[model samples]
Target: MEPRKLLSSLFYFSLLSLLSANQQVVDSAHHHHHHRHRHLFDFRPSKLFVFGDSYADTGNIGRSLAGSWKQPYGITFPGKPAGRFSDGRVLTDYLVEIGTALLLIAAKFVGIKSPIPYKFRRVGGKHLRNGMNFAYGGTGVFQSTSPLPNMTTQIGFFQQLIKEGVYNSLELQQSSVALLVLSGNDYSAYISKNGSSQGFPSFITQVVNQLVLNLKMIQELGLKKIAVTTLQPLGCLPFSTAASSFQQCNGTQNALVNLHNLLLQQAVAKLNNETTNDHSTFVILDLNTAFMTVFTNKGDHLGSTRFENPLKPCCVGISNGDVCGSVDESGTKKYTVCENPEAAFFWDTVHPTQAGWRSVYSALQANLQQL
Candidate 1:
């Protein structure tokens, strides 16, 4: 019953097919090629404005309370924690990284680095042209568990930067994309705050309503394109999957997620209808479906990704009392990392590994072209 012991038993999975994983990556590139030529003639954005919680946080959180600043968080990419909530790159990084390589691949994308965090805006002055990532760990559309800035406050920071003449409106309207990664921190806060399950439906409506307002604010701010991710399947996250020994998702929780995603789609459709002239005013990344695709196709590696333990986190606490980033008084780590992070899906309890995000992004490529 011990936590680490439970992991030791659960992780008796067969050795993952590294060749299959590599082939999956190659197939992902080929899918990108399917649309590569299409992007060549499109007006590719040079700047990316990111907002939301830890799912897209790129070092905006400080070292005091965030595990992102601790060891093993970013070991897969930068070789150390650079504040991304995962092992390495997140959805935000994949977007910028892939788009930056467009120039060479016939996609006509201009090279751009991950947007500088607002926390480093002063020292990272020149990089402001690449846009800003104002997202913080554990934040939500409304007030959430962590005391960091919520969506409103994050947007306020972006507005303040504009007021200081840190950005030009013309460039924003001409060649910038706003990525809003809202991955259900609101529901986490709701449950943690003892919100009644009976009122959950109404709360989901309220969350999506506020989210629509945020999208409008960003759109009215003159960004050329705005992309918002639908809520991923929260019920399939490791925390929810633990009850199934990482074999199946919690269907009860997933039903709620389906409701949330439906509402979000309706809201986005209305917004696009009202504001779209020649181009779409808003873009949906279909994250909910993408996540489902990965989960449902876990064992069928014929044409999809190969995640042997799709619901199991790669890193976990060695004991029930510890967490992925827990350390003892001696400053010794209390967690265990899998031998191959690239072969895992979920990184900790909630976020994905770099490979996990890569797979999810690969699955979402068709949806991404809308952006």
Candidate 2:
């Protein structure tokens, strides 16, 4: 899949997992208020540091430079383009929405909202407590399609913030969760550079090695927990499945994704073993299984909702060459949107509809318990 498309898909999956977990907490709270309160108090973190690509980025991308900032992107939520690649709220926005709701309903609880993007933290104040987001859309562990900072550079920004005393050691040690999302932008770049299939395995190894190093560095910086997402099945994305009339996933592409996830799991295990601490500091969020479950079930996981054709997007360009939100020189719209986005699984050629994400979260309920 294309890097940008993969980023959006993974972003939705990540947020779906988060929202699913939060919903469970909310449900438990309703059933057993005191028990849920105690659980929240015990696990609440003081700050959350987000890194990776567009999947986790709240608003790090430049408005004018990114297509996300254009019309129809945020038509569902904010009712205007809000720098999100979807028709409405993307992953990070949903995180904030759920967190805010938690704060309102649970008075004693202190919910962790999506962090401010690193670019907008220059005028930092109380918002710093929520931590900072260092992700950029279209970026990867290595350079990708975007001119924005890569994973290494994003980490450098985090290091700079710590060095400048933006976050004290005591604060970091007390409570902090670092979310690292690397959703295959590196592979996309490699393919675009004419890399061969034979060289793909070695390339994946290199990516995972650097990722492991990055996680360790975050641990050394005093983060108690670091969650890294396993890459989702790339072949199952709309971009790849389009060739099959969106009916079946490309086996070759999915095989590559499995290899990447296997290596990542091994690396996380090693990192945990190397740590002197008694508890695990590094964890993997299983996106592959979650995605497969939802796709296989065709959104039937949710009792009340059943998408007719889960693979067919709700919005698309008028023809093959066009895309969702596309327009001609004369200012003519070239795309079509479903009357009800809730009935479709995908919002575009790349990203999922908000309802689609909700179902995905439902499918991921079991896996999210690991977090």
Winning candidate number (lDDT): 1
lDDT of 2 by residue, 57-162 (tens): 6678887555577767777766887666667765554444454222322233366776788888888898787888888877777755556788888988998888
lDDT for 163 in candidate 2 is 96
Kindly list the per-residue Cα lDDT of model 1 for residues 178-284, writing each as its tens digit.
88877776776666557898998999899889989999889778774676776777767787788788888777777777677677767766665576343434556
Cα lDDT for residue 215, candidate 2: 91
Evaluate model 2: give its TM-score: 0.83
After superposition, candidate 2 runs with Cα above 4 Å error? 1-43, 95-110
Q: TM-score each candidate.
A: 0.84, 0.83
lDDT of each: 0.69, 0.66
